[model samples]
Target chain A: MLRIGLFVVTVIGALVAAAPLIAIAGSNPLSAYRALLQGSLGSRRGLAETLIAATPLLTCGLAVAVSFQGGLFNIGVEGQLVIGGLIAGAIGAEVSLPAGIHVVVAILGAALGGALWALVPALLKAFRGVHEVITTIMLNYVAFSVSTYLVSPGGPLVSKTQPSATEKVKATAHLARIWQPTRLHLGVVVAIGLCAACWFFLYRTTAGYRLRMVGANPTAAQFNGINVRGVVVRTMCLSGALAGCAGAIEVLGLHGRYFDSFSPGYGFDSIAVALLGMMNPLGVAAAAAFFGMLRAGSVLLQAKAKVSKDMVTVISGLVVAFVAARVVLERRLESSASRRDRRRRDG
Target chain B: MADVFSINLVVSGIYLSMPLILAAFGGLLSERSGVINMALEGEMLFGAFSAVAFTWWLGSPWLGLLAALMTGALIGAIHAWLSVTLRANQIVAATAINLIASGLTAALIETVWGKPGVSPSVRKFGIVHIPLAGHLPFLGRIVERLTVLDWAGLLLAPIVWIVLFRTSFGLRLRSCGEGPEAAASVGVAVISVRYRAVILSGMLAAAGGAYLSLAQVGVFQRNITGGRGYLALAAMIFGKWRPVPVLGACLLFGLADAFQFRAQVAGVNLPHDLLLALPYLVALVALATFVGRASAPAAIGKHFIKD
Candidate 1:
């Protein structure tokens, strides 16, 4: 019941956040809501598309959430994801195997790629005391370049002259849609399973407890002999792995090739999603889906409502701005509550 | 050939070094005075965009520079008001400023120019010939053919060094950054000192942004800073919070950038990403091998309030 109440509040918040999009769409606010609901969840096709869109975001949000839970901001998830995609794409270009084994390699390679990208920043933070936020941001740019170099036209972007992607990752490597003509594929299952796994790890495991304790207070954790530095490194690596998986899924299941600059700032978006979801794996999952719907329906909204496609960014930016401006939010809520209290007292 | 290249490399180093110097110097001032300013990049972006727009409009690069400086100062004052005065979390405030700047700037570009990427190239401030040095030897060869701003930056090095170390006012400012409580106890108005430091940082970062637009690239692009602000932050760290090392770190980054630029020009089929990633990789290497046990100011980021 508590979860349901929180979910409803967040949903309303999302709608309120998307108000600017409504104005841009030139449709009445209520009509925009109806269109969004009908377009994303009202039909089986819409639901599947939303699920597909949610897959990478869900995993990426969890990746960010897990790291933030450990008090380490992981902004390199985009970079990690890109590296993972490159590895997956490279593997995809090589051998032929049973689809299952091929998928396993793709996922594994991606996880490793993300983890490796994160390792540098993790080491610097642990050993040299450099801020991960700064390091991770710089790494993101490097990741962008690395992926572009790997997948450019002369490289993996063009194997032959058809202007198609790196020769279709052996037929076995493809993550075919589970539902025909829908974007839904094997990755959605993985995303949900991983979310469950994260919830259990954070709430039920001893290792997770140590991480939480360390995240809350490193000095106290150190006094208690908990290896704070070790936890920081491990959590960051784990976080990067999940983020890398997001990239891998996008490549293996959706696009089937490593594309240069594929992400539209997923790493930064995940920051807002993780925070809005209160850093709960379940909440992050829900938030990711909510974002997924917005993204999936945005194309339709733009076409039918005559809105510039960029309205979605404005809406997302507003949501992040509102959430981050917690001081302003708290003050508004406080003043409103006090006014009500004054009325009650006088009455 | 490599020597000429190396000389050109060092010249590019000096060129790239100036902006980082400006941004890092700004960051140091804000950080030293107890504010963790992550909005340095945003301040630069604000400067970069304004500089381009002003240059396009007025055709005087100096006017563009002035616009950038003001934009940077405005952002700094906004940050100081929210974080320093209102006691908001400095990181959160800075992040908000960054986001707002990004979205608003892009939106402004779309509305104004109908494009989301780089602005039109303008004739900007660039290499200037020093009157007598061009006629002289090795030192003259290096120093004579430099940008007006390049000379200003080298000029600023000792000026800032003296202001920070030699003067009583500099002592009071450092006191505000190092230990506000100590400074406050001694009757220094810690808040005002910090406010001034941050404002100065914003102004310098803004000027650096203008340098990027009006001098470096001569055009504005979304995210044109491309992690330079963080690079500046890294330099600030590697410099151990001092002016000389700050300049050195910037020069190192500039050298890396110059090499990458030359390598790309040579078209050696070296992955562009490797070149793009060079500065960050060098930063990590520099921090790991070079900087040893650098300690930040004691009261950095802790807001001091007299109860």
Candidate 2:
């Protein structure tokens, strides 16, 4: 019952956080929400756009969620996405193969690229005890710089002299769309499937159980004979792999080619979505869809209202803070309960 | 021409290092207190934007710098509320600050200037060549070229060192950071001390941002600090949360940045892309070495709730 109360407050916080955006829009905040719901669900086109926007977010949110489950904050998803896309684009433009093979190569290449991006931090955290949060962030800047160079004129990675882009992927390599008009594609389905897979991996399997135990209490897990060190490295690796695949999926299923500086921090934004979702894979999917709707609606909101599109971001931030506050409060309540139990037993 | 290039590189290195050192020191305070203080970048943005906006109005960069400091303090207060008093997840609060700061600054710039970005021309923070320092050779030249902000920022290290290790307030701050329970037992007001430390840290970081806008650039860009806050935080971490070491880390990163720009200008055939990756690479390498087993204050990143 208390848990339910916590959940209600979480939603209320989200609503309150979203209030400023509506006020800025000069519409009834309820109407603004109605428009958002109507805009996204009013027609098939709206739904498609919501789903389209959610596609990358769902993948990225899961990527973030996986890391949180492993006691690591993999905030470098933005960097990994770019790295994966760069590799895929580098390969996608050059490789000549059957459409299936070409697509597979790009996807696999992107995943590898993302994993490689994660490797440095994983190694650093595992051996050097560097905090993943700090290194991954620094790595993000490096990733951006490298990606910028790759896409810039006279860059070794891409012909920088050209407009900031790489060669488009082959037509055959394009993702099959669920809707012809909107951006909805195979990646959405793939994202959901991956979420299910992650759900299974974290909940159903012994390895998953050990990973959760480690996340919840590393010492306790160690006492229970769990290979804590091994879990840290492998779980981080797994998290990175998921993050890499998110990047790969975005590039292949949507953008159709890798390019430097494509995502406007989808990786980072997913962190918010993951938190909102309570770090559960299924919850991530739901939160991603909601966030994606707001994202897709931002342009529309701007076009209709004079409010700067950036206000949407402010709302997102407030929501994240509120969610975090809730998490902290919940933990405190749980610990207090346990302490009470301890006192009762002692008495 | 070669000498000119080297001189310019040295100038640029210190120029870049100024704000970073200040912000990292600011981070050092909070990190020592156990808060991650990710909002440093946003606070810097607040400083940069407010400084540029007000300086343009008041016609004095000094006033602009003060405004930036106040803004940073306010931001620091907000962070303190969320992360310290409210006991929220530090990263969530920090990252939220980053996004909100970026978005708010962009939006505010639009509202204030009636332009999307790069605010209207303001009084540029001028170059201050110290008369005495101007006499020396290459080394003297670098010192002479330092701006007013540069001098103030350079002095921050020793001041922070004293405050963090020598002063009573500093001791209390560390007590809260290293172990809040012990700190509370010792009669230190753990939450209040942390609030002071983190807010002061924000004010300092804002000064860094002010250096960027009021002095470094005449205008503001949406992503102006461009992950420098994170870099500074890394420097703090690499410095292992120590004042002098944090300064060292900032200089190291500043050097990487300075060299990268020089290398780019020298126009070598080697991939400039690689140069771009060097700071991050250096960070990874540094973390692998010094970051290993680096002990943090026990209560760092964990909020102390009174039992």
Candidate 3:
């Protein structure tokens, strides 16, 4: 109940903060918000669009959450996703196979690409004692640069005819559409399935238990004979694979091609989503959907309300800040309460 | 002509190094005080935006620099409050600040200036010439062309080294980073010291951002800092949290940036993106190869608990 209350408060606080900005932009906050709702949920098409946007975010959220569970901060999700998507795109355009096989191959390619991208940071953290945060962040720029080069005019992945993007993926590689009016595809179902799979992997499996044990206390885990180093590297690889799938899904489901700078910070946004959802799969799904709605609605907010799409970024940032602040506040309260209880007993 | 070109390259490199040294110095102050300031990027961005915005409003680059410092310090206080007082995850708190700054600055730019892409150009600091020395042969050419801001920024390294190593306040700050419990036992207030250090750090970083906007670009773009804050953090690590070494690292990065720009001007056939990626790639390589085993403050990311 407290969690629900906090969530409501955060949402309200973010909206309130955004209200003035909307007003400054010469739009009525209430009407603009109403338009946002209408844009994201008023029609079946709008709902489908929301689902489409949420799909990759859910996968990326899972990626970050899984790594967080392993006590590793994976800031390379953006790079991993980009590399994975590029591999998927290349495979989709070049390979010829049956629909099922083609899709599987492309997805696998994406997973491989992401894993390769994540390998450097994982090794550095596990063996070399390097911090994952900075390395991962650095890799993000490297991935961006490499991907851009590959898709640019002289790059190998660039289409002969279209200079800015890779060639179209084969029809067989495309995720089949579930909703006719919208871009909703099998990617959503796959994303959900992956979320369920992640939940199972984290909760039910012995390896998962070991990974969590390491995260909880690395020294204790080591004393218990757990191979802490192996777990760290493996956990990163698994997380990277999930992020890779997010990239592949985007290419296979919606764009059907890979272009430079396709994502507008979806990978980074997933970190907040994971935190907001308390690192739970179901919670991540809900959080991703909420953000997805805001993103989907931002277009309408821009079009009808004359508000800039950047306003959504401000709102999301506010929500993230508020959520983090609440967690910190709650912890302080708990500590203080315990302290008070001890004092009373001692007295 | 090549001599002039070389001089231009060196001067531009120094110009690029100015913001980095300031921001990295800020990182150093916070880290030395046991607070991991991952929000340097956000602080710099806010500083960059505020510097240009204030400069436009006040029509004075000096006042704009002051505004940037205050804004940076204010954001730093928020970060210190979240990380130190609330014991929030420092990384998460910093990330929040980055997002908030990115969004809020962009929104403000759009709402106030009516343009989402870039802000209006503002008055900027002028170039300086070391009067007598500027007339000398080799050094004169480069020294005469350096901006006033660049000279001050370069001088900051030695100043920070002195403050961090020579002062009693610096001792307390270092003690907090090394062992807060020990610091607290010795009649030192760990929390307040950290707060002050972080806020001061933010102000210094804002000076870096102001240099970017008012001294370098003369206008604020959405991401004017452009990961230079992170580069500064990398430099901090590369310097092993010391002022002098960090200055050298910043200079190296600046030189890479200067080379990229010069190459672009020379119409080099390399992909533009590749050229842009050079500095980041160099930092990554440096981090992995040379700085992998670098030592950090003992209690850097640890939350202090009053037991």
Q: Report the number of the highest-DockQ candidate.
A: 2
| lDDT for residue A120 in candidate 1, whole number 0-100 | 86
- Pitting candidate 2 against candidate 3, the one with the higher TM-score is 3
User: Please, what is the whole-model Cα lDDT of each candidate in the order they appear?
Assistant: 0.78, 0.80, 0.86
DockQ value of candidate 1: 0.32
Which ten contiguous residues of candidate 3 chain A have the minimum total lDDT?
A1-10
Give the alpha carbon lDDT tens digit for every residue of B79-188 in model 2: 99999878887988898888878777877776677778668878877777667877787788788777789888889999989987899999888888888899899799
Instruction: Name the 10 consecutive residues with the lowest summed lDDT in model 2 chain B.
Output: B1-10
Per-residue lDDT for B193-293 in model 3, tens only?
99999999899888899999899989998878878888899888877888888999999988888887887787777877778888888787777776446
Model 2: lDDT to the true structure: 0.80
Query: Which runs in model 1 stand beyond 4 Å of their true positions?
Result: A1-50, A153-158, A161-165, A297-321, A327-347, B1-4, B126-129, B267-269
lDDT of 3 by residue, A225-314 (tens): 999999999989988999999999999999999878888878887887787777778778888998889888888888888787777777
- Can you give the lDDT of residue A61 in candidate 1? 91
Error of 2 at B290 (Å): 1.2
List candidate 2 segments past 4 Å from native.
Answer: A1-8, A21-35, A156-162, A328-347, B1-5, B271-273
DockQ (C-alpha) of model 3? 0.58
